[model samples]
Target: MIKNEIKIKSEEGEVFDKKQIALAIRNSTFDDDLRCSLLDDGILDKCQGCNLRYICDGIDQVVDSYVDKTTEVVNNFDFE
Candidate 1:
């Protein structure tokens, strides 16, 4: 870990840093729309199904929110 690092844990307990996640998103060749197995169930689901889901939680809105939050944190984070 560093002053600015993207460390993330998958629903399956797997870990992914920023670069790994970014690459997975950028290099994905799948055409199916991401979906969360636990969408609207009031609890997060494990990273099941597609590989995208493994790293992205398989929900578009959730992924977007995660990205937005990450950006916000990066922009405002005060590293000491």
Candidate 2:
């Protein structure tokens, strides 16, 4: 794997590199709001009617904060 390459894993266990993600975003026909809505759909898909879905949703806020911190870390990372 290349150092400094941003990667995201999808719900289906597929990993996408930064360029792939960018390309998908660029090629997407959906508008920004729709895209955001799709994220909600994805969350629902992950939840799949689990009883703890609400708890997981609440934890998502913490995950968002962690992502912010991680983005900062990634921005300032020294691979050497």
Clashes in each model (backbone N, CA, C under 3 Å)?
Answer: 0, 0
Residues 1-80 of candidate 2: C-alpha lDDT, one tens digit per residue = 75434566679775758675444433342342112333466655554667775765655554455446555433565698
Write model 1 residue lDDT over 1-80, tens digit each, in one string: 44333565678774658675555454342443444556557465554554566445443555565566655433565689
lDDT for 7 in candidate 2 is 67
Per-candidate TM-scores read 0.23, 0.26
In terms of lDDT, the poorest run of 10 residues in model 1 is: 26-35
Cα error, candidate 1, residue 71 (Å): 23
- Model 2 ranges with Cα > 4 A deviation: 1-48, 73-80
Top of the candidates by TM-score: 2
lDDT for every model?
0.52, 0.51
Q: Kindly provide the TM-score of model 1 when superposed on the true structure, using C-alpha atoms.
A: 0.23
RMSD of 2: 12.8
Top candidate (lDDT):
1
Clashing pairs in 2: none
